[model samples]
Target: MSATQSHRGVGSAVALPPLSNGPHRKRLGLVALIATFGGLLFGYDTGVINGALRPMTAELGLTPFTEGIVASSLVFAAAIGALSGGRISDGWGRRKTIILLAVLFFAGTLVCVFTPSVGVLVVGRVLLGLAVGGASAVVPVFLAEMAPFEIRGSLAGRNELMIVVGQLAAFVVNAIIGIVWGDVPGVWRIMLAVCALPAIALFFGMLRVPESPRWLVEKGRHDEALAVLRSVRSEDRALAELGEVENVAKEERESQQIGWRAVFSNKNLFRILLVGIGLGVAQQLTGINSIMYYGQTVLVESGFNESGALIANIAPGVIAVIGGVIALTLMDRIDRRKTFILGLALTTSCHLLIGFASMMLPVGNPIRPFVILFLVVAFVGSMQTFLNVAVWVYLSEVFPLHMRGFGTGVSIFFLWVVNGFLSLFFPSLVAGLGITGTFFLFAVVGALALVFVVKQVPETRGRTLEALEEDVTTGAIYLVHKNQG
Candidate 1:
């Protein structure tokens, strides 16, 4: 059968036009929003600890090293979750994978909220970390697969925006909870429990959402896949998409091997995997997580009282959300490479300024908190505006469709592993070198990342996933080979 004929008649049914109307758009948005609640839980579980940690440490008698362990335990678990979530999503389908994540989210938070010992707390955090890792990997892929190519960036971009919104929500909640019941014996429990609400919402909402059509095609449920496609897209467009998806799924099946080993054996796939991992690692090195997980601590160390630091910590969250809003508007217009380079440059400058100010400000000086706080906010703004959305979008889009899930999972696993170590050792780094020394290290990493982004990253702002996959998998993107071929 010809390509056009096969697409026009799927098995035996006539191809219908794609749906592009109110009901379909609303359903798509609702699904995206539900999956994003996992991001919200991720942000809150991680960010709430920033403010809650001080009081929790006092109550639980944690040492600096132990503090690092406690904070990083979740991140380490998340690495495992990220590594595994992709394979699971591939096997189980995106909707079911996320529904499972919701269960983990609720259960993990419940354990953390009531834990009496540090060991138990660590266990709970590890569980939460797994959920976070899964959410981070699956949410973007699910959105990218479901969204139309024209709005794919914005729709997939929405998950990252939701993550920051979740982080901001955590910050605001911490501030309010810390102030209203400041002297309560277990105030941090309240901060942690707040995530339960979102977790429940995610699980219930996902029960009603449709499974990803791509997953259906991969599983050889072609008619069901076409039905799903028809729900969101016009019938003709949906059939066209399903045909393309079916073709790629067939290619993947013929390849018959998909894993880290296959990815490494193909030198070009290796390069793409490296780029994905590099982007994840680079995104973390910007030190944005430091703020989310320890913003209040950083502010206090900069010389503010508990009350003042709690209040001041909200600034970055506010700016981050605003930057995210701007990013949504600009994502379609901007080049991915340029936005990434710009983010690295701006964030690197912020790190240097922060480190310099910390060194220049004498202990007990009034200006120190204000200066460091401003710089921190600047860093968050730069990251939210440029790197966060682009990194996730690129990682999701850069790989051949055959390896998208496994590749993203591997890259994100290493990404979270690096983040785990950083979170674990950050306080020690601060203790040994002070804030100036700490941020100075970030500045060095940022400079290296900027060089990597400008020289190696590809532009992916306005291409369909099929187009991108074809270009990327064939080595068409590298300038040296494009004309030679």
Candidate 2:
């Protein structure tokens, strides 16, 4: 293949053939749309708490400690969900696991919307958290497995976009509800209730989509895998791709190291697992979720009144959507490593600026809140554009098929764990350290994240999953760095 053709595949020597302008393309688009509803739910469920928490706190007479427990419970449960979801999807099939998650989303939403006490709310949140974490682990992998390598990044990235869109939707819904019914008791329940509609949609929508072809091949179901592939790919491409996948699956099976054992027995697999965990941890430590879960609190501390802060929280949600759109456009055009490097750098700079602005402006300054808000918005934009979508897509791609579910689950488990702890203690951190000290702490962490990316992250763009798998399993991916030096 010429360089031009191969560039479409990012860096692969073998270029994929042009997709047929057939119904298969439309089918692929439909599948992506339906599957991304899982992401939408993930976003809405997580972000709704940003605005709803205060109202719920008032209704239930929650203390800061109880509020933290209510908020962190879902996140902590999600950590468990991510771990189990991966294993379940690996055994139960991706499509089926998603369907199960849809059920969980619905059940959890009901629990939250109707719960009379904090205890019941915590129970609800845990259910929702499981669904959210499962979606986090499974959705991107499902998308990647369904897509051709040529446009895999964008395809997989659509879930992240949906996630942000869902978050934006939550912010918008929360603002409208809070503003329109500011005096109404239990209005936060309405905010949570909105999540149930999408859960219903995802359940029915997933029923119409085919299972992941790569996953089917992994289970030795060649005919079924081919059928699924044919629905999304052209006739010749489906056959060829199936053959390639089968070859890789055969090699994986013959090696006889699967799941955690594969990771432990093979040095390369273990290294990749560590890399996956590192990426997940690094992404969370950037403090993005701290804002997502508690933007209203941050804004109030910065200087905005409660209502104004509720409204202003929408700004980050809006920019996040915009950034996600731009990221989807760039996913195929830019290399994954470059995106990580740039995202970390931009986010770190924004964190430092936010800290310094808070310090210089102080509490009484008229412009302190606006300046801080603008910096927070900038930080979110940088994260969505450069890191969030890219990290999810890369995690979905890096693991070999045999261990993909386990690997992604384990990695995102840590991601959610870190996120849960941060969400739990962020309010306390800010109360103790104030905005300047808190953000300065984030800045320090962001700087360290940058170093980790530059040192350890590898380029995965422009390669087939199977090709990438070969490189990852054999440790040849590390050679790229050595060769560059």
Candidate 3:
């Protein structure tokens, strides 16, 4: 599968033949790398707290109640961030909006690092949360718009890959710091500081990247859109894609106005939006994030001591990174529907396995913690490889260009809300029900989520975003694509 290369004016809307390789791929890769720094910061900011929370709790004199509040503040803020980010990107353009998010990320990190009181820390977390939520919604959409259809899945999925990589880095950093400076009073501040580097990186990196070409077309800057597409796409493909964008834009202009009213009034658009919402909500229901946020707690409850659990919590993060790599490889090759169905199947089974293991094994038994951890790691791997990338990519591509940002924002806002609720209540759930009851509940919810995907989710695997928009608006995208093999 070599991509054919040509040196031609990308700014001209001329049709060209398809081939793999060359400068176009390089430019696209560079753009993806830069844009995905947002994902790295998102991952780092969110995961840093997983290990930092214990130290932060001690330093802040937090109770279990205050601990939940501290931990969930960012998540609650993220919900608002997702909604506002969507509107900002739609109004201000994705590239510039990311630049603003970088500033917020930097400022928020400083606030958390320098804060003397819990109230100040909460304010800081909310600011950081806005950046995280914005990144989560915008990065994938930005990449999706930039990438050629042939490889859009893998390229867009890079954001998820970077996210897990960021988590892995946090885990490693926390482990090293925890081992060496186990008694340090302000170790959490150092953990929070690591996020600032990526924030600075993203702020500068985006300067070199072009705005989304489709977005330019949406805003009536067709010439600038062509220039951007030319830099990253072959002359022929750029023209073809730009033509598609024009047609869609023309259709949108003729048919309806785009906003909250259009989204709710149009049945097709509303249905697709509901699908995005379902995917967002269903992904979080798997309990993957609970492990991400509180891996140490789960491990300690299973059997390991505090120190052992802190160090041991890195296992899931490692598996998450590995699984993300595998997912990127599979993204363009596999059907979206298959990935979701298989992921939910594996994760659901892992949940059941964890619950049963906890029920059967006594806490004093040495094998108990290891078995539960094994299942948790397996679940995380299944999720990263199959579900996370698929869901994010699908949401980014499913909406019409007019509503892409708004639709994804609304969907992810709910996703963050679910994430916040779980982050807040998970400790209580664990403390009250123990591992068995908690996991069984996840298994039940996962089973239901699997059913939803099997029934309602559409296949977006080989289609261009414009083609997808066409099918989705006509409500023809719900059918599954079967392989000729």
Candidate 4:
């Protein structure tokens, strides 16, 4: 092909493919949707704890500190899960790894549903965390590799969309259970047990989806990779993609040493890892999960009762899904760096709004709940639309083929660790400092994260993964300093 033709083909693969009229394209889209249920389960489990904790605390007699532990233990374990998940996916294949995560999800949900003590509950949560971490690290990679570059952003983005959907699912389910079965001593168990249903769906779904074609190439199964790619893409497109994957694999093996060590040995790789971790940590520091995982309780403490809080929490979930839809539309249009920086700025302002609202509107004020809840929704909307999908897509796309797993694992591990710590202490922070102080702290972190993102991150939109990898691996992005220094 001529250079112009080659550029066009690569562009089609990278941009979101326009809605297709063909059966094959439709089939591929459906397959992507089905496989993304893993993302859904991940979103649900993490968010369910937000509302479930209220009843779980009462039943389990959890102190504020213990409640923090219960909430955060899974986050800590998820870091382990994200780290280990990469190696496992690299070896077992993405499909098998997802199936394994489904099993963990089922078992963890069962443990939590039946547990009589807080220790057992925490154990179940840790197991669940492992699955969450693994899914977070692997699912986006799986989707990205499987999707046509044309629609890759939106298709790979579907996982993030499912994440918000899952959160919405959790909010809806928690509300129904809390309101209808509010009198039950252990209603929280039922809330958690609901996760098992999706776990079952995800397990069976994985059995049907093919392994990632890029993974097959990494394992030297080029024929198999091409076969898998052909199922989702045109024959010409599949062959082209296969060549790209193989070329990268060949160059990667020549260096003969590609792993987490490469992250440190190569300054460029190390810089990419730092950027990845910064994105993950910054995404968390926005306190998105704090809202998703604890929104109901926050609403309750702000003055709404159990039923009112459950009903009110839906606002954020609704906005989250809406934001995700908006993100899907903008994934290809907005520069990734700008979206993230904009997200931090908007979310920081929301935090300030929330803090000020909480402080100005006394507990007795009827407007307190609406104002705080609306601001929380605004925060969730801004985050889901910008940072959430962009970070995952960038992580999945930026790394070279050989070290993709390790790079993603390192990034997500720290992401989950921060998430875990935040999950653990946020409630206590809220308890001790009240909403104003807690949000003030988030605002400060948000500002700091904004600075880091603006200075360190690079634009990744409209570039093929291979092109991005080439730029990243060669220190091309940072080469401007060659003359300056």
Which candidate's lDDT is highest?
2
Give the best candidate by TM-score: 2
Which stretches of model 2 miss by more than 4 angstroms? 1-16
Residue lDDT tens for model 2, 70-165: 889999999999999999999999999999999999999999999978889999999999999999999999999898888899999999999999
- Local accuracy of candidate 3 as per-residue lDDT tens digits, 1-485: 13332111121232335845779889888999999999998888888888999999888898877888888899989999999999899999999999999999999999999999999999999999999999999999999988877788999999998998898899889988888886988999888888889999999999888999999999999999999988987787788778877977888788774666788787878988998999999999998888998899899999999889888899999999999999999998999989999999999999999999999999799899899888899999999999998899988888888899999999999999999999999999998999999999999999999988877887887766776776776666653222221
Task: Give the C-alpha lDDT of model 1.
Answer: 0.83
Q: What ranking emerges by TM-score with the best candidate at the front?
A: 2, 3, 4, 1
- Model 1 lDDT tens row, 115-137: 99999999999999999999988
TM-score of 3: 0.95
Candidate 2 residue 445 Cα shift, in angstroms, is 0.7
Count clashes in each candidate, considering only residues at least 3 apart in sequence or on different chains: 11, 4, 9, 10
Q: If the candidates were sorted by their lDDT against the true structure, best first, what order would they fall in?
A: 2, 3, 4, 1
Which stretches of candidate 4 lie above 4 Å from their native place?
Answer: 1-21, 479-485
TM-score, cand. 1 vs. native: 0.93
Model 2: worst 10 consecutive residues (lDDT sum): 1-10
Q: Itemize residue pairs with steric clashes in candidate 4.
A: 12-150, 13-149, 13-150, 14-149, 15-150, 16-150, 16-151, 17-150, 17-151, 50-293
> Model 2: what TM-score?
0.97
Q: In model 1, how many backbone clashes occur?
A: 11
What is the lDDT of every predicted structure here?
A: 0.83, 0.92, 0.88, 0.83
